[model samples]
Target: MDYIIDVKELRKEFTSHSSRSGLKGAFRDLFTRNYTIKTAVDDISLQIKKGEMVGYIGENGAGKSTTIKMLTGILTPTSGHVRVNGMNPHKDREQFVRSIGVVFGQRSQLWWDIAVQESFRLLKKVYNVPDEFYNTHMADVIETLAIEPLLDKPVRKLSLGQRMRCELAAALIHNPPLLFLDEPTIGLDVLVKLKIREFLKEINAKYGTTILLTTHDLSDIEALCERVIMLDEGKIIYDGALRQLRENWGEGKQIQFSFAEEATHAELQSLTHDHLVVWDQGSNASNWTASVENNEDIISAVIGQVVGAKKIADLKIVEITTEEIIRNIYEEGAVRNG
Candidate 1:
C-alpha cells in the first residue's frame, strides 16, 4: 500500500505555568516560578494509505488537536517525526500545504464579514490557483456540496449547516489530495449530517483523498472511517479496523422486540441472564429491549430464550455502536486492560 501519512514516535509537550492574577501573586509567581511538563502527545505512530479515512478520537485534552497541529505544520513536535506525502510537513510547509486542506470547525477559514464567494476568491489568490483550475474546481464543489445558494450570502448570515457546506467547498477549492477535518459535523441536524457524510464518501471515492478526522461525534467515525485510532492521555490505546474494535470492546449486541401486549418486568427477567439489561416501558410498554454479549457459547441460547415466532413482532441484531464502545473503554477500562 502507498502510504500518504507516515508518523513515527511522534510526541509533543507544553510547559504549563502557574500564572498569578493579582499584583502580589504576579510578582511572587514571576520570582518563584512553578511549572509542569504536560505531555500533549505521547510516543505514537501510524500509517495511513492514500484514500483512507481514519478517525482520531480522544477526550478534550487527549492530544487530538496537538497531533493535527504537528501534521499541519502549526506546531513542532518535542520529538519524533511525521511525513505527509513523503515530505516533512514542518520543513516543507509551503509545498506540503498545497497538497492538503484543513477545516477547523470552530474557526472559519472564510472571512467573517465578506460574502462566501469573496472569501473563496481571496483564497484563490493566496494559493495562487490558476483561473481555469479555480473556476472548474469551485464549480464542481459548489454543485456537489450544494453551496450555490450560499455563494452570495455573507458568512455571518448563513446558518451553521450552510456555513459548514461553504467551509468544505472552500477547503476543496485547491483540490488537495489530503483533507483534515476537525469536528466538521459538530452541530448539525440529522439531514445535514447525513448529507455531509455522503459528500465526504463521494469525495473519497471519486478523488481518493486521504482524510484524517478528529471528532466527538462517534457517528462520524462509524459512518466514514473504516480504521479508528483511539487516544487516551496522549497515548494511542486502540488502533485497528472499526469492526475489530466493536467486536473486542463493544459492550454487547442489542436485540429489540415488540409484543402484542404489555409484558411484565418479572417475565422479561426470566428470559435472560441473571443480570438483565432491558428498557421497555415507554408509551407502549408492550415492547421489550435486552442486550447480551455476543459470544459463541450463549448467543443461540440467548436468542432462543428471547424470541419466539409469534411473540416477537420484530427482531433484529444491532452491533454495539462506536459511542458505546468508547464509553465502555473509558468507564470500565476494558480495552486498555486488553
Candidate 2:
C-alpha cells in the first residue's frame, strides 16, 4: 500500500546560546559560547494512509507544530527519515508542497491586501491549475463554505469567522490529496465551526482527501477524527481509535435522572443516601445524579432500580469528555510512549 505520509525515527533538535546576566558572564560568553540543546521531536515513527482523517493532539510545546513543519517541508529534520508522498519534504520541497494543503489557524496564507477571489486566482497560477479544474473546484468550495459573498472583500476586511471560511477555501483551491489543519477553529462561533466541519466531511467523502487535524478543541477531534495520535514532551504517548482512548483513559461517567414534578421530596429523599444522590434545585426534588465507575453492569442495575422508584421524565448517561481524560493522563504521568 502506498501511504501518504511515512515517518521513521524522526528527531529534531535546536541549539540556543545562553549566558548569565552579568558583566563578567557577558565577557566569558563572548570568548566561549554556552549552548543549550532542546529536542522538539524525539525518535518518533508513524504512517498515514490515504483518506484517513487522523487527529494529532497535545498541549503547548508538545512538538505538534514542529512535526507539521517538518512534514510540510518548512523545517528539516535533524535525524531520521520523513517521506510525504514518496519524496523527502526538505529535499523535494517545491514538488512535495503541491501534493498537500496546509491551513494554520493563527496565520493567513492569502495576500492580506488582496481580494479573496484575486488570491485564489494567484494560487491557481502558482499551482499551475488547469482552468477547467479550477473553475469546477472553486464553485464546489464556494458553495460548501458559503464564501462567495465574501469573495470580493479583501482578506484584511473579513471577520474572523468569515476569514476562516476563506482560508479553508484557499487551501483547497488546488484540491491537494493530503491536507494538514492546525487549530482550524480556534476562535470561531458555533455556526461557523459547524459549517467548516461539514465542509471538511464533504471534501473527504467526495475526493477521498486525507486530513491530519491538530487542535486545542477536543470537539473538532471528536467530531471529525476516528483515529487520534496524542503527543507529549516531543514524543507520541497515545495513538489509536478515539473510542478506545476514551474507554481506557476516562475516569468515569455520570448518569443524570430527572423525575416528574409530582414526585414529593420525601419520595426521593432515600435516593440521596442510596445509589444516586439528589442535586437540590430550588424547591424541586426532581434532578438526581449517580456516578458509575468505568464501564460496568452497575449502570444498568442503577437504572433498573431508579425506574421502579419514580416516574422518570428524562435520563441521560454522560460519558467523560476527551479533554478530561487527557488531562487526567497528563496529571498522573500515564504516558503511553507509543
Which one wins on lDDT? 2
List model 2 lDDT by residue over 1-338, tens digit each: 78899999999999999886799999898899889999999999999999999999989999999999999999999999899989999999889888999999999999999899999999999999999999998998999899989999999999999999999999998899999999999999999999999999999999999999999999999999999999999999998999889878675777777877555555555643454433334335677656566546766766777688778899888876788788878888797643
TM-score of each: 0.83, 0.84
- In model 1, the runs with Cα more than 4 Å from the true position are 19-27, 255-290, 295-317, 336-338
Global CA lDDT computed for model 2: 0.87
Q: Can you write out model 1's per-residue Cα lDDT over 253-315, one digit (the tens) per residue?
A: 766767776777777777665444554453576776666767645656666776652376666
In candidate 1, the residue pairs with backbone N, CA or C atoms under 3 Å apart (3 or more residues apart, or in different chains) clash, namely: none
Best by TM-score: 2
Candidate 2 TM-score versus the reference: 0.84
